[model samples]
Target: MSALDRSAATPARVWLIWVALVVALAVPIAAAAASPLLAWRGPVYIAAGFAGIAALALQLVQPLLAGGHLPGLSAYRGRRLHRWVGALLVLAVVIHVAGLWITSPPDVVDALLFRSPTPFSNWGVIAMAAVFAVALLALLRRRLRIGPRLWRIVHMTLALVIVLGSIVHAVLIEGTMETMSKVALCALVFVATAKVVADLKGRAKRSASP
Candidate 1:
């Protein structure tokens, strides 16, 4: 096999890549927490915010795009990995939003109930609600008897909605997101969402082919 293929095939390399990403994520968090003044604060917080949102976006996209990945590592292991990672993603999003609320409670409250005058606030609320709904569905998945195919479809659709709302919110926010890191992270969310849709379309096409 080619060198690139060999490297990609190595689970150890995949684990290393994940570890590297975790470390890379910590760097910006440290930087953001260092500032005090409003001008200095926005970029830092924005970078951190992007990390949390990205985590949620990745988690939301995983089941639909690569739900069976964990099993390939070990028998029946994929489902457990999926559950753990998905829960972690949800927790990250909660912490992200909570941080925003802590920084500006009044604004958050206004945003949450749709009374906020800002354009981004409405979109943020919608995205937050979509994430909450996805969590609810996951919690009630067994009781709902949502078949795998149907569940995947609904989950992806909601994920798309969340990403769209989040992008609008981020784009409209004037603070905490000026740095290149924050911009790239938001872009990744959009790209990830587009990829999910593309994957779903590809599956549909294959299924329809004679």
Candidate 2:
């Protein structure tokens, strides 16, 4: 292709990437916004619920950012943004649990302690723990003396935990999120992360070879 053709295509490709991401993230939240259940909930509960939806949607972005799959973002910048998004994700999870605690401390305690009757509760707690572990490792990366490739592997593994656990937790809950959109979001997250992890693993293997 000529320089003119390439230049013309670049902006369009960037827009396409961004437009798709926006649709993927926004549809679930939009579905939740229309949910009839929100009318029965209080302000705190609604906020907390949306925070969770936000967190779930943010999961899709994390792998894309980390893999530098999003257009117009370099690998370094994307990974930097990935760290910030990870922090925001933690904050969302905190709000989710804190709000639930405010409404029902015993339930939240049971969930955290792995004593909850609901199966989703256990998965949620497990996912939350993995998230915290990943964040702590990222913060202490230098202090822990972990190499970059090893760090990526650990991060990817924990990230898979977070994504899968969150999927199960959300799917099992009969709450605000619209069913189809929620499932679609989860599938996209699964695919995106799987792609990134596969690529990273392939690169690692090639690096180790002659």
Candidate RMSDs in Å, in order, are: 5.2, 2.9
Cα lDDT tens digits for candidate 2, 1-210: 223533555788979989999999999999999999999999999988998899898999998888777777666778789999999999999999999889789999999999999999998898999999999999999998999888978998999999999999999999999999999999999999899899889988999999
Clashing pairs in 2: none
**Tens digits of per-residue lDDT for model 1, 173-197:** 6553345545555665576567756
Clashes of each: 3, 0
- Per-model lDDT: 0.63, 0.90
For model 1, state the Cα shift of residue 168 in Å: 2.4
Best by TM-score: 2
- Reference-based TM-score, model 2: 0.94
